[model samples]
Target: MNEVANPGSSAVVLIGTAEYDHADVERVPSVSANLDDLYDALLDPGIWGVPAENITVLRDERDPASVYDAIRAAARSTRDDGLFLVYYAGHGFPYDDDLVLGLREVDPQFPDEKGLRYPKIRQATQLAIALRRVVILDCCFAGRAGREVLDAGDAVKQIAGRAEISAEETYLLVAVGPNELAKAPLNDRHTAFTSALLHVLTTGSETADPVLSIRTVAEKVIRRVVAAGHRRPEFRAANAAVDAPLVRNARLRPHDLTGVVLEATADVTDPELRGAVILVLRHNDSGALGVRLNRDFGPLPAALDGWRDHVSLPDRLFDGGPVAQDGFISLVRLREHEERPIRFTEVTGLLGSLPLSDAQQSARDRIADLRIFRGYLGWRPGALERLVTHGRLRITDTNPFHAAFARAPFTRTGS
Candidate 1:
């Protein structure tokens, strides 16, 4: 049985730099431009389902030196409470049995000679020695980076001999096998391995094992990659005798509440809802309460969809649950200092409720123009708290920009 684990206990490092000065390997236009996308995806509050303070992201454009230092810090730190994830996306080159991750200026001809250097697998294993590490390498030849360090006899002996290990443990999940090449599909705009990995982790396709173990996530990623037209990715387990849980053990139990009503049953209709923050709504016979947020809703439009007649709200309504597919409701928050005459019920200081107007034509227009949802998330008062206590549900605090508006709804051209 999979055990529930706390997400707050971990730290994540995202390093991506594609501006290689010397190389025929077409500098992945998407890698450099989509650095923020990769960063945002990892740092997404919804992904962690935990508080912002618990997660930290180090990217190339923001701080280059700190990226390496952060990895070293994680390696040295002794925190057995949370999991640690390190994601690297860019060019990867194999050196004999070992692999080297290229930084921004890595020259294909001279990997070690040029640009910043870090032992992709060795450094990750060093960090895993102390914490539960889920190292995701999205670059080519990533599989070879950690092979040597993990296979070291001394390291294996030290971990294997231990009699008792905690449920919270460390592991690694690489994108491809050491011998195989990792390729991103042109249509998906993401590496085949990565796309499959994300799908299994978030799509709830593997819901039977909600707290995914290293073995399980690895198997799913490998299968998905191969099925998607790529070579089989590899799965390596270190210190298996330790019996550490791969994914944190947790469960997000369903909540039963009479407050709000949802409009949709399936998540397919709203592609935006996938891997996004949303507001769920539930309707009672008399009225309804729109769950302020079902997931982590991203950015809001700078201006309302159609603000000519009345100053519109800044948020877009999204499908929150699998219930009503056509019903629409919204929770609008006034600007920090700006006050309006509209009457509303306060869900929280930062969130308020506004009912759909009675006018049929106006209501239809509002629903069509704005991003409205059919259903919402319904949580009985204590149910959410219970899930949090059991490590099932995580409430994330995110900035409006980072949550929704920062990146384009669609991937940038090259990405």
Candidate 2:
């Protein structure tokens, strides 16, 4: 699985209420349980990458002030370009040409002032500095929330379209039509809509995808829920909506190759890394460091002309991992000669590494077998290990003693 690294911070506000004061309104049996299901999904590390401190759950909050206060507090904690999601799984419906989410003490006498207004939520979401604002209204008249938020435009086709810094995306999913009743099956822990959502997350996702977007999940939920006799759920994208891949399935998690050698299996996905052998230089709790010894880019750069003939592979240079391209590294072969006036670290009796300046200081005729590398491959902690466990890599010998031109795994991307 691809590790989740958000472009910004993450904040979530989940509001659900099973208790209401109005005697005229029927209670939603699965409101609180639906929240519980979503809350559990949010806490899962294999799902959304949010830390525990970033989420807030308001269950049966009685006052509108308290609800807004908690939501604003959660929003304030998020940095710009972060994600802010608000999930409401209670009662909601069309009121005075707008939608209003019910509060714990909601009364029919004044729905506009006493209830949680959809426009207020929409306005707050639009005004928030977060880059992604998602609102999932699992209640009646949910589609009206989408109507109030989205502009009259065609929905975006591609999820990974080019991004704009000034643009913010709003993805809204409602359970029922503007005038329909939200499903609330009696004796069920969660509503049919949310239950379908859970089923999809737990089993319906396709493993081939590296990231599972909210749109994908919503579609699956809608399909299963509709097939079970519920009204068609509504999905809307406001402003510039892009795919948000927040859910993760650990069944497809990658291997962890700490301290182990990686041998590419025949089924390796990338052509560049297929049939390639690698030597694990360092794999620690912090990150992994390795180099591809097989890839040789014909001739070395003209800049390192001070002592070209001194090294065995002076004419060859390899592209390391695609990280910092400005950095240069080398692996020099050790020999039985008077050590040159340069600082070097000996890895094995026959392998050593030194600075470029030091390597250039060797005498013109001195024999210094060296391999130059531009940039270097790196994996954050367990990433390389995941690649190995995923069958993309295998373990090999640590013997640095090899041919002058060793194997290399440069030129790689999202495996």
Which candidate's TM-score is highest? 2
TM-score for each of the candidates: 0.55, 0.59
Q: How does candidate 1 score on lDDT?
A: 0.49
lDDT of 1 by residue, 1-415 (tens): 4452344555556666555666465555445434455444433322334334544454343333555666767554435655666767777777655666766656677676543344633454366434566677777766775553353235467666778644434455666667666675554555566667666554434365445566666777778787877877665545544434444222332333222222222332334323334332332333333332334233443434544244343454444455454565544444554453245444444344456553333333322122334455444434333333344333344543233223234331111
Segments in model 1 whose C-alpha atoms lie over 4 Å from true places? 1-4, 32-47, 58-65, 74-78, 115-121, 124-130, 148-170, 242-415
| Candidate 1 displacement at residue 198 in angstroms | 1.2
How well is each residue in 1-415 modelled by candidate 2, as lDDT tens digits?
1423242377889998788888977788688878777877765544554666888889988888778877888777777657788988888857887788988778766776668988878766665567667788888877777564443135553333536523666788788878888888989889878888777765536667755777777788789989999998877776544566656664454333333345678868775466555655555568777666665544678877755556666556775545576877776666667664356655455465567766444432343577777766777655565465344775666455663244444433323
- Angstrom error of the Cα, residue 231, model 1: value is 1.3
